[model samples]
Target chain A: MKKLINNPSDVVNEQLLGLAAAHPELHLSLAPRYVCRKDIPQGKVAVVSGGGSGHDPLHCGYVGFGMLDGACPGEIFTSPTPDQMYECAKHVDRGAGVLFIVKNYTGDVLNFETSAELCKMDGIQVQCILIDDDVAVKGGGHTSGRRGVGLTVLAEKIVGAAAQAGYSLGACADLCRRINQNGRSMGVALSSCIIPEAGETTFLLDNDEIELGIGIHGEQGVERRCMASVDILVELMVEHIFSDPEYVRVAREMNSASGEWEDVQLVSTPFSRGESFIVLVNGMGGTPPGELYGVYRKFAELCDEKGVSIKRNLVGTYISSLEMQGCSITMLRADDEMVRLWDARAVTPGLCFPSCDDVTSCGTSNAD
Target chain B: MLTKKNVLIWFEKSADAMAEHKQELHLLDAAIGDGDHGINMNRGFGKLALELPVMGAMTLQEIFKHAGMVLLSTVGGASGPLYGTLFLKGAATVGTSEALDASAVLTFFDAGVEGLVARGRTEENDKTMYDVWAPVLREYELCLEAEMEFVEILAACVCAAEVGMKATIPMLARKGRASYLGERSIGHQDPGATSSYYLINALYESIRE
Candidate 1:
């Protein structure tokens, strides 16, 4: 409850205004509340992703060169309405098409699906890819399957790069699905974060306990256990990600031919013994970078021990859940193409590459 | 008698009831959900309350459609689309009818539940509003088969909804945010189901008044 804000209801609005002011490359639309890249290239597939507001530097931070073309933020921990997404997509589409990258929560999935439908009705080609990389819950649960966490940032980066490279809408969507399938994430929370509107934490944990397999939102994790050392925690999380069975589930894909949703079964290939990985040691907001590096230190050692080569690694707060004190580890099986895409230069408010001089010359950026 | 005016009254009463129970719903949601069910529901209905004056001149189908559109635009969550779909699909069933008979009411409920099922992909035991709505539809059909009057059938449906809402207390959540709690989701009444019960009860009360 003790946070710096004027009012609980205006938190998202005020934060969005600040984000818009800070990031001049992004254009903010107030009526529908979406942020889009100001200088979008012509004839390139547009990449859009969004969800609740608490997971900052995610959909919005990824909205620049070689990443998201637009993002629609909703209320805290609530999915954005379809109208906002529809309007955002309409404005961002540059005559090629728009691809929606959605996390696999029920509200997000439902809202994104509705938005895609609306866009299609308005004569815009739309494709949606659902990200469900969290290893906490089994597939086909009473609720939606796994929640999309850190891997969402990875997907946005890779797919955004693909779109920037002039990949077709179908190609971008396929790459997104591949990234989603190859990634697995596991998280543990030392404490819960308070939601601004609720004025309380979603859950409580004792000083001696931690919740395992926690989602990005302040929701309870799959299990609770006595607190362990950082190395032990990293070992446990790495093992869970490595040992998870091949994920199989049914997802909705847009049937461009008939303009309806078609049921498509997707399978996530399990990690092999000698596969290479793009690893991310992500903080859940409250954790410091020093501690995150502590997680990566043990994580890298464990990967080396398991014969899994770390092709690339990002250790920081790429995605977060309010100010919850926790960290999640994401491992995406990376090939040469994925590694190359991961290294692509990007500039946004949340992520920036100072070495990249001109955004227009990079990739398929055409000055329009 | 279920006239167009009665339908408008039903919506007004439903909005009022949701506003009254807003805090209670938020408390229930705090236990297992993100704690915005009451806030979102009240916001949706509050918009409907504002539109009621303008909606008074529309046909039953138009009124329901307007209500659905308002909820879809104003309520920014899972319930927005789910409840909005319910009203939109229900409006489709009413077609050009000026008022509703028992059979027409049954048709509306059937379509509303179907829309909810299609949107949410929830089954009977998913611990959602479907649990309440499915029973209400079934009980209304039975009441209609017994040649009950429109108000009596509505009363019966409201009673069924109450029972269904209470039944959600011991059920494990299989859908929505509460499902993340797994077994811990049990013992708390579902906020969506509770709001649905109030909506149906408000319908009956509007007719009685």
Candidate 2:
């Protein structure tokens, strides 16, 4: 209630204006609240994404040379209007096609579907890739699927690289599926967020409480109990992701969908690792990057124990929950070609990769 | 009594009650669900009050349909869609009827409850809106079958609605955010049912006038 702002209603618009002013390389549309690259490449595949506001530098900051083509930012923790997303498709259309990266939320899904219908009226081709990487809440009949968390940002990054690298619409979309399939994310929220208009916290939790698998919007998680040591929380999150049989099936489908079968890249060899990936350690808002990296150490330790090679690592506040303290870990298992795309250099105000490296397949833990 | 002006009065009274009890509703939901029920319902009814005067002497069905639109566009949550659809479905059944008699009112309420069931996909014991709606509908039908006068019928429906609302206290939630709490959801009253009772109370007060 006693925070800095001109007005509650104008908070989202004012922040978007500031974003536009800071990032000259991105195009900003006020009506639709879309942030797209200044120069949309002609006849190339376009990656479109969106979600509620408050998770700044996500869909917007990812709009750069090697990431998302456009992002439709909506109201705080609410889905954007269908017209907003439809207009985003208009501005970012490159003629090859546009791929919509949608999160797994009922409102988000319904609004995106409405936007897709509008795009179809214009004879533009589009496909949807739903990111439901959270392993918790799968058994709940109330939810359509698990919430999309850190994997969404990673998927946009990987698939954006593929689209920027001159891949066809179909090929780019296939890569998106691959990224979504092989990735998983889980989060814990130490506190709840305070919506500006509401003038109070969205939910109140005791000082010793933490909710496991909580979403960025402060949506109820799979479990709520007294807080525990970071190691125990990490085990619970990782156990569900690594032990689920469905996760492996999804990985298999992704490998084939991205056309890895047609290419000779599926095999492990001396020259390159069969597959490499970047580990994304994301902090919900109010959590510092230092703490995020602390969680990242655990992700790295787990990958080493499992013999899964991690070529690169990203640890920071890529996604946030508007002043909620917590962190989510996402593991993007990438193939040979995917590792190359991920290694490609890119610069944006929100995310930057200034360095890249290649390593052997499977366990390189014994090395360094 | 039961004039169109009385309908307007009922809405005004309900808005005041909702405002007064807003905090209590929020506290009930604080444990099992998001703590926005009181504010959300109050806002929905507030908008309904602002628009009721402009309904232009339409039939009860038309008036309800207009009220449904105001709630759907302004409420901005799950309850908005569910409750809005309920009213609209009820209006659809009444369809240009000039007046609402005993049996006509019962049929309309039944349609509204059925619409809630379809929208939420919940059943009688789901610890949802139906927990209140189903019992109120049953009592309403009985009153109509007994050939009770309009005022007496309204009183019966409101009493039934209250009983249904309070009955939510002991049941386990089977839908929405409350369901996520499992056994923890048992102690708190269902916020949706509490709001539905206010809606029914508003309807009865309108007729009693």
Reference-based lDDT, each prediction: 0.87, 0.73
Instruction: State residue B203's C-alpha deviation in candidate 1, in Å.
Output: 1.6
lDDT of 1 by residue, A190-297 (tens): 989888877888788999989999888866666899999999999999889989988898889898678788888889988877999998999999999999999999
Candidate 2 residues lying further than 4 Å off, grouped into runs, are: A6-10, A20-52, A59-132, A136-145, A155-183, A189-214, A217-236, A244-279, A311-313, A332-368, B1-14, B57-66, B88-115, B141-152
Q: Candidate 2 — which pairs collide?
A: A285-A321
lDDT of 2 by residue, A1-368 (tens): 66678899899889888888987777888865788887877988888999878897787878877788889887677666566777888888889878889886645654565566457768777777678777665554443446678989878877888888888877886787767777777788999888887778887899999988887888777789999887788877777666654532111111223322121111111112244667788888888878877777777787777667888778888888888899887777777777788876666668765432212222125444
Local error of candidate 1 at A43, Å?
Answer: 2.5
Point out where model 1 deviates above 4 Å: A353-368
Q: What clash pairs does model 1 have?
A: A142-B174, A143-B174
Model 2: what is its DockQ? 0.09
Tens-digit lDDT string for candidate 1 (B95-182): 8988888798778879988988988889987899999999999998898899988889888988899999999999999898888777
